[model samples]
Target: MNPASPLDNVRIVLSHTSHPGNIGATARAMKTMGLSRLYLVNPKSFPDSEADARASNARDILESACVCTSLEEAMGDTFLAAALTARSRDLSHPTRNARQAAGELIRYAHHHPVALLFGRESAGLTSAEISHCQLTVQIPANSAYSSLNLAAAVQIMAYELRMVLEEGVVADEPDPQLPEPASLQEIEGLHHHLEQVMVQSGFLDPTQPKRLMRRMRRLFARTRLEKEEVNILRGLLTAVNPHKPT
Candidate 1:
């Protein structure tokens, strides 16, 4: 059997999309760029006639889309996720232009599943939602009217990725012998374990987190943690709190 295409490991994730037509248009856009994986997180509507109609000749993309209840769920198996947002957030992840991010994303996708995350049409990704991502990608547009339609944003990103792939543009490749990158789910587990230890140790007050964990997340997100590294950190946390359950 042929090896899976790197694009196959790159999924387009739409979260809390309020409009069905945008979802269909997004599928159509992805299809045009040779992207097939689509993940919908808590969409307002799906399997709707409007969406089907908007999908045009790309109904198969919509039909195969994965529906998720949460952004975390949508990104569970992904090793890297880039949040597409025009708005600035406090302590946001490292920012990259669309073209720059596409190169990096494609490089990572060659090793593991990666995601390009888009938020709702009316409002972009929530701060908490963006926190789940490792990088933030912005499509350069007129500052006076930076807002882009949901499908349009997806199309822009998909086009950039397609161009990167076609042009053979990729970021500095990591050593192939390095350990695999940790999945989002695994990283989340490490976060949870660290938070539990922090709360128990009085380092982080649950009542007033005051962005403590958020900062930690930002720090770790920059690390591009590996699977073994995550396990080692979790082990350290456990060692620090031996009484706590594993």
Candidate 2:
């Protein structure tokens, strides 16, 4: 069965792409997988002849690639956005390998439009850019020489997502039926609440609190806590500091 939406509908966003050839190659990759939506966020150059030459017949992808002023604009309405990065992020947003990320892309696409984010070629996505995503995607590489080029990275990931579309799942992923995650606003509030509790209880010394919060934030992000877990934590904080005030 064909995908419910056209390839033109799948937006492949590139932030600060420096190579024209890589942009062309990325278009080819999406075309081969029947995914066509390409969004360019402040790309180095567009309508480059080199890019068109590399795209060949897939020039349509280049021709139609949406140019956005910012990454925020490109991914604003997208329900699920995954930023591909090679290194670990400092804030430690949820991370998934290529295969697992492909599954999530499929699942999220079931309800809302999804966006796959790619960063510049020299260095992959920056920490700030990754923070913009709900989760991060990393491809497992050999212990040595782990760097992947922009086009190659997108090609590998796009191939994985296409495989999921072509071949149905062999074993279904577990379904916990958890409610949606708390909004970013609520999560930020939870962090503030937790911070207040830590300070009021003398659990964290103000002078050394940065390291403590950084590690704790990393620990908390991995849980991918559902709305309920966050609520539980909020309630726990209230119990701990009845008079601390939010």
Indicate which candidate wins on lDDT. Answer: 1
User: Can you write out model 2's per-residue Cα lDDT over 1-246, one digit (the tens) per residue?
Assistant: 365632333468999999888899899988888888899988888879889988878999998888998876788656567888887856677889999988877765654567889998888787666655677889999769888878888889888887876677733342457466544445556777988889888888977777676666556555555667789999999988956556
- Cα lDDT tens digits, model 1, 1-246, are 024667888999999889999999999999898899999998999988999999999999999999999888789889999999996678989999999999889888877899999987878888888889999999999999998999999999999988987786564365767778899999999999998899889888899874988898999999989999999999899899846766
lDDT, candidate 2, residue 80? Answer: 64
- Top TM-score hit: 1
TM-scores, one per candidate: 0.94, 0.72
Candidate 1 wrongly placed segments (more than 4 Å) = 1-3, 171-174
lDDT of each: 0.89, 0.76
Clashing pairs in 2: 7-36
Error of 2 at 118 (Å): 1.1
Error of 1 at 192 (Å): 0.2
RMSD of 2: 4.8
Candidate 1: lDDT of 207?
A: 96
